[model samples]
Target: LILIILSPLYLPILNEIISIITLSYIYLKVKTILKSTQKKDNEELTYSLKTHLSGIKNFEA
Candidate 1:
């Protein structure tokens, strides 16, 4: 039957769409986590640098 023949084709297409959507969701989650980590790291670095500069100024005076 033509219906039987078409069912197999539809299954693979449906699977492929599901795979694409799952991968995209994973990618966005990873990107968001990385961005937040980067921001935290930058803030820590800035704080450390400021502390070091003040220490040096105190030593000079």
Candidate 2:
């Protein structure tokens, strides 16, 4: 079709828009992953601390 043939004229601007959208999507996904991992790490640290304190208590008793 003639429209398809002429699409190349807009390819530059379209490509730029697509790249911006894709980068934003990727950035959001990475940020969510980082936040979840940080929360999990904090939870693990608390659990480990409780275990360490319990171990100390057992030794004292």
Candidate 3:
């Protein structure tokens, strides 16, 4: 009878903890993805700018 009485209380608390951990994991993963994507975008932009500047230099000659 004691076991049955405690089970419900334990289960809900355990489930809530698990849910919080899962959400934190997901949030971190999304943040990592965004960071990498931003890095890639910046790299591409710099590359394009370099190429354009080079073309203008050639034209000036």
Candidate 4:
């Protein structure tokens, strides 16, 4: 019976906590995804640059 009376007071705080946790989880997942994509792009760019430089050197010889 006392719980019934107090439930409203706790509900909003609980909702806020849940929302914060969910948002944090989403933010971390997005950050991880962006880092992985950026790393892949860097690797590709480095490989292409190296290949292009080698091609130029071979042409010079």
Candidate 5:
């Protein structure tokens, strides 16, 4: 069949496109996860800092 004749020529290009899509999808997932984790870390840091500062204030008072 003509399909078989052309498949070898197109297969590499198809593979490249599929790989690119998969990589971008993975990259996006990792980016969102990192963003969420960073936000949580920032929130915890701020809370701890606030408590520490308040403790100092009480000690000084």
Candidate 6:
């Protein structure tokens, strides 16, 4: 058997983290779709998406 207790402090922090990650993922996916100039194959699409995402600057603290 297992039991878990949640802390009040953790909930808001976790929600913010998850929301940021989800929004970033969606933004990248949409940008990858919009930036392709020509029709791409599956491999090409994946490669382009990776390339576009890699070009994103690292967040500064």
lDDT of candidate 4?
0.68
The segments of candidate 4 whose C-alpha lies over 4 angstroms from its true place after superposition are 40-61
Clashes counted in candidate 3 amount to 0
Q: List TM-score per model, in order.
A: 0.54, 0.51, 0.56, 0.60, 0.59, 0.49
By summed lDDT, which 10 consecutive residues of candidate 2 come out lowest? 51-60
Runs in model 5 with CA error above 4 Å? 40-61
lDDT of 1 by residue, 1-61 (tens): 9999899999999989977876675566556555656757767655655665566457546
lDDT of 4 at 61: 69
* Candidate of highest TM-score: 4
Which ranges of candidate 3 are over 4 A from the true structure?
Answer: 40-61
The count of backbone overlaps in candidate 5 is 0
lDDT of 5: 0.68
Q: For candidate 3, report its TM-score.
A: 0.56
Window of ten residues with lowest summed lDDT in model 1? 51-60
lDDT of 3 by residue, 1-61 (tens): 9999999999989989977876676566556555656757767655655665566457546
Report the C-alpha lDDT of model 4 over 1-61, residue by residue, as the tens digit: 9999999999999999977876676566556556656757767655655665566457546
lDDT of each residue in 1-61, candidate 6, tens digit only: 1223555567788889977996787697757575773566677777766675665434321
Give the distance in Å from residue 4's predicted Cα in candidate 3 to where it truly belongs: 3.3
lDDT of 6: 0.66
C-alpha-based local distance difference test score of model 2:
0.67
**Model 4: colliding residue pairs:** none
Error of 1 at 12 (Å): 0.7
